[model samples]
Target: MTQQNPGSAPDEESPAGDPWHAFGYLVAGVAMYGFLGWLADRWLGTSFLVVLGILLGAGLGLYMTFARFNRPPDPQSKQEKN
Candidate 1:
């Protein structure tokens, strides 16, 4: 007697979900790392740490984004739905 809405699956990704989420992650990572690097440069009187931090942040962000978004969905979840 229970009816499920055809469009109500929780596993479905909205059309704008992944890309926007990835973009937000990348921007936040870059800004946070860059700010930390800038602080380090100010404290240590060095000129290179800001650039390094930005690069490291970008690399890490990209790695995280791809790792999270590019993987296939879990097989167990699919089976459980049925």
Candidate 2:
């Protein structure tokens, strides 16, 4: 049997994968929505849309992060591996 490296992990279970993905989702969501909100605020001459946009972005980001990283493993794939 081949041995795994002590410091190595499979891609699925890799420690370096999830945090960066989550952070990217969050930052991208916030940046995108925040920009939209700022634009809306500017157009409407209002100040609250930016905050609302940021909140919405953050919520969506969290949702995406959870959805992506919290998935259940596929039984078919497991069986195939075995």
Candidate 3:
């Protein structure tokens, strides 16, 4: 027989889990894209490259944001037994 703990479940709602991780990921991605754009502009001496970088970065960031919302609640922190 297995003993279950309160609020412990394989699937639980945690507001502090995925949102923070997803935000961090989004920030890092944006920063990376910005850096790449700066590098491209510095090396190529063209602003178009930077613009492209921004567009790509924004697209990727939005994708990640949407993906995070689609994911299920955290399983590790779920409290099973009440």
Candidate 4:
């Protein structure tokens, strides 16, 4: 019998395969939304919009991360079980 390499990279469908990609998504969401909020604050002369924007961004990022990482396995992948 042949042994598989423990150090081999995981496939794209595995969450462990690309942690940085998920992190990038979260950071990008926060930065983009926060920047938008900052612009709105400057335009409206309000200090709260920036805070709101950051919160909204964080919530969205968390939701996206959870959704992407905690999904049901694909039906096609189940065929490999046999």
Of the candidates shown, which would achieve the greatest lDDT relative to the real structure? 2
Off by over 4 Å in 1: 1-7, 10-17
lDDT of 2 by residue, 17-80 (tens): 4588899999999999999999999999999999999999999999999898777876864654
Query: Candidate 1, residue 65: CA error in Å?
Result: 0.6
Distance from true location, Cα of 17 in model 4, Å: 4.7
Candidate with maximal TM-score? 2
Q: How many residue pairs clash (N, CA or C atoms closer than 3 angstroms) in each of the candidate models, in the order given? A: 0, 0, 9, 0
The C-alpha RMSD of each candidate to the native structure, in angstroms, is: 3.4, 4.7, 4.7, 5.1
How do these models rank on lDDT, best leading? 2, 1, 4, 3
TM-score of each: 0.74, 0.77, 0.58, 0.74
lDDT by residue (tens digit), candidate 4, 1-82: 5453476443434443367767887888889889999999999999898888888888888888788778788886555434
Q: Give residue 33's error in model 1 in angstroms.
A: 0.6
By TM-score, how accurate is candidate 1?
Answer: 0.74
In candidate 3, stretches whose alpha carbon ends up further than 4 angstroms from where it belongs are 5-18, 72-82
lDDT, candidate 3, 17-37, per-residue tens: 467777776777777887899
